[model samples]
Target: MKFKIEFSGHENIRSNHQKTIEITKESHLTPQGDCIVGVNANHACADLPQDLKEKLKNPDSKITFSIDVGEHNFTIEGKGHPDLILTHDEDIVIRKSDFVCPRTLAVKCDKASDLLPREMVSMLQDPKTKGTFTITVD
Candidate 1:
């Protein structure tokens, strides 16, 4: 599938930087049954506040990111997983929670149950839904 993640606004929560960045999705799904998407953080690292990046690396962080698919906006929040890592190529890890039923879909994210609505996850499970999606970071 082909998709783009748009990062706009200033670096930190507050800044006047007018830079906007777009990163393409490398692939989906991880070895441990998770949905993985990443972009080189360096592309917009200069605009981002240092603290936000630190928070992203912290397992206890409560930061939430949004993924917009057509009119539906699904959310993915931070999971305090020890394996979760945020570096130059920021990998957004979506894990399957206990709420998700067993499935054969390769597009499912393990951490997504708590982050995304069940119905949205169901829609994504459909192979027809693959192709283009957007991750908006503001």
Candidate 2:
């Protein structure tokens, strides 16, 4: 099967360009039915608000986002933050056990910051920032 995932947010918090990800079933899904999708840390985490960052640190934190696949639309709730960590040599590693996969979907951001870009931060403060990523499995 083939999977296509798209991530989006409020106009201000949205990525500068269309962000889509593709994964092959044979590579991303394990025999136990566990599916792993790599997220762009720079795009997803670097600009989060301080409170959200704190929330993500908890092992039980959950973030809700919307998703659209062909004619079906729904929401995906993620548990905790991804385990990706950036190293000095620009390599990424899984620092946590949340994701039990052998590979990652994307590179980790250099670091996560409490202060988001002005536009995104304003939207979060005003509570206008909301977005979702669609996952297509075929």
Candidate 3:
């Protein structure tokens, strides 16, 4: 199954957090949101399609999360965990940790905000930049 989110960048995007990458439905950003790569998101945790969310709750499921901004593309490979509840209303978070939370889409992620290409991060800092965030489960 697959899900996609459309979101816009923000001037405050720092993309410096070491463990997680976040996309939020909120339209504004703060410097403290170092893990946030995209804002004004079209989908949050709770808005995901029910079948996709179901796959995301299975520990055996393989999940691929990707982001494309302008000409740059990046991807993270991870797994779903039974612990995932997928109920957060404002954010979708991908984490390198196994800890599951309402906002977490995948755990044991291979990449996070700090590991994103600096060039892509630069593009994501522009408020006018549009990005696509995609999640695929297999």
Measured by lDDT, the strongest candidate is 3
- Which digits, one per residue and each the tens of the lDDT, describe model 3 over residues 57-137? 899998998899988999999999988989999999999999888999899999999989999899988999999999999
Backbone clash count, each prediction separately: 9, 1, 0
Best by TM-score: 3
Worst 10 residues of 2 by lDDT: 86-95
TM-score head-to-head 2 vs 3, winner:
3
Off by over 4 Å in 2: 1-42, 68-72, 81-97, 100-131, 134-138
Q: Each candidate: what lDDT? A: 0.33, 0.29, 0.93
Clashing pairs in 3: none
The estimated TM-scores of all candidates read: 0.36, 0.30, 0.98
Error of 1 at 123 (Å): 9.4
Please give the range of 10 consecutive residues that has the lowest summed lDDT in model 1: 8-17
State model 1's lDDT.
0.33
Q: Write the per-residue lDDT of candidate 1 for residues 27-112, one digit (tens) a residue.
A: 33332332322222223222334454444334454444455544566554433333333332433333333121111111122233
Error of 1 at 108 (Å): 15
Residue-by-residue lDDT tens digits, candidate 2, 1-28: 1223333222222212112221221212
